[model samples]
Target: MNLNPDQVSNYVTKYADVLVDYSLKLVSAFIILFVGIYAIRLINRIITKVMVQRNLDPTLTKFLSDILIWALRILLFVTFISKLGIETSSFVAILGAMGLAVGLSLQGSLSNFAGGMLIIVFKPFKVGDTIEAQGVIATVSEIQIFVTKMITGNNQTVFVPNGSLSNGTIINYSMQGERKADLTFSISYDSDIKKAKEVLLEVLTKNPKVLKKPAPEVFVKNLTAASIDFAVRPWATNANYGSVVSDTLENCKVALDEAGISIQPYTIQK
Candidate 1:
């Protein structure tokens, strides 16, 4: 139909006003987003600085900071979208569902993180402690949010997930100041048990690493079909445990051999 010019002008004006309003809202939304992002970054930096000053656990600090940043950014984005006059209830509901999905999908990771928190709070172990956990023995190098780093005696780096560590048994060898070294050696059935004990005593006395407080002693641990086994226990500082054991055993062997004591090697029977 051939419409009136005035009616056509009115329609154009109405459409132009709606476009201009939307354009203004869009510009405002952009401005808010940029400022909100900047503010989130600034707040995260401040939180990090505070955590550092307070000497908080590095893993937890970083994790919490990241969560705070993401949460704030999400809120800012939702607000920005709301400025454009769009419904947010469904958006929020979908976001909630996504969060639930993420939580379920990342259950293992979340468990590790929670385990780390428990370890940190309960003081079960700490960095630099020699620990045997989950069938692995190593010195703890770092404690992270989801995993604990360790260096074995062989100098191998191992990463243990905190979930298992927290739930499993942890033998902390370094927690105590001192430990006992148990050395057992076999002697011929005819060997003089008295003389062998004397030799072990000498070995313990000569070693500087052996602590004199607890003192060292030697006794017959067992008598098998072939030979008698002597148990030599020497107390030493945890720092000297490995070396002390090595040196003590070598000294005992040499001492017994020099004393003309018959040393019998234990033979496994078929």
Candidate 2:
């Protein structure tokens, strides 16, 4: 069947109109999408700058800014799809399902992240502070988003998960201005307690690093199976802890030996 020329022209014109309508809709959608994304990014940058000016923690500032930007961009995308006559309820539902699945898989990591946030906000221990936490003793090197980095006395770096750090007991040695050096020495029972105390006091007095405010304590602590234990508790600066400890031990031994007191060693019978 041969078609008339006028009929063919009318069909072409109708098809062109449909194509132009669709093209306009697509162009509108793309423009809105690009503008929305740019706005979100601009808002994120402004928020980050404001936070930085307010002296907020860098990690928290970045995290919150990124979250805000993503939330806004997602909202804009949903609105753009709705403008294009697409149903968004199903899309939102799918996103919710995917988010739940991902969250469940990352529960532990999320917990750790939350713990780290708590630690930062509460200011339990800052970097460079010596702390004993989670059965590990070390100086805090860095406090990250999910873990706390520590440098041990032996110069080894250790990373403690924030979840465990937040839940466990944290002993911050650097919090206090001074720390006590608890040193115990064993002497023969025959040794004179009064004379021993005097010698120990002399050792502490000779040491310039020992703090004078809290007087050094020297007393008989206990009577063990082999000898009598004497406790010497002295206050010292944190930086001089090891040095003072080593010096105290060496000087105490010398002082005791000079006073004719002998260290009682436990004897094992074969």
lDDT of 1: 0.88
Across 96-198, the per-residue lDDT of candidate 1 in tens digits comes to 9998999999999999989988987786777788999999999999988899999998999999999999999999988887888777788987888898889
- lDDT string, candidate 2, 13-75, tens digits: 999999888788878988999999888888888999999999986667766786798789889
Residue pairs in collision within model 2: none
RMSD of 1: 4.4
RMSD of each: 4.4, 4.9
Q: Which 10-residue window of candidate 1 scores lowest in summed lDDT?
A: 261-270
Q: How accurate locally, in lDDT, is each candidate? A: 0.88, 0.86
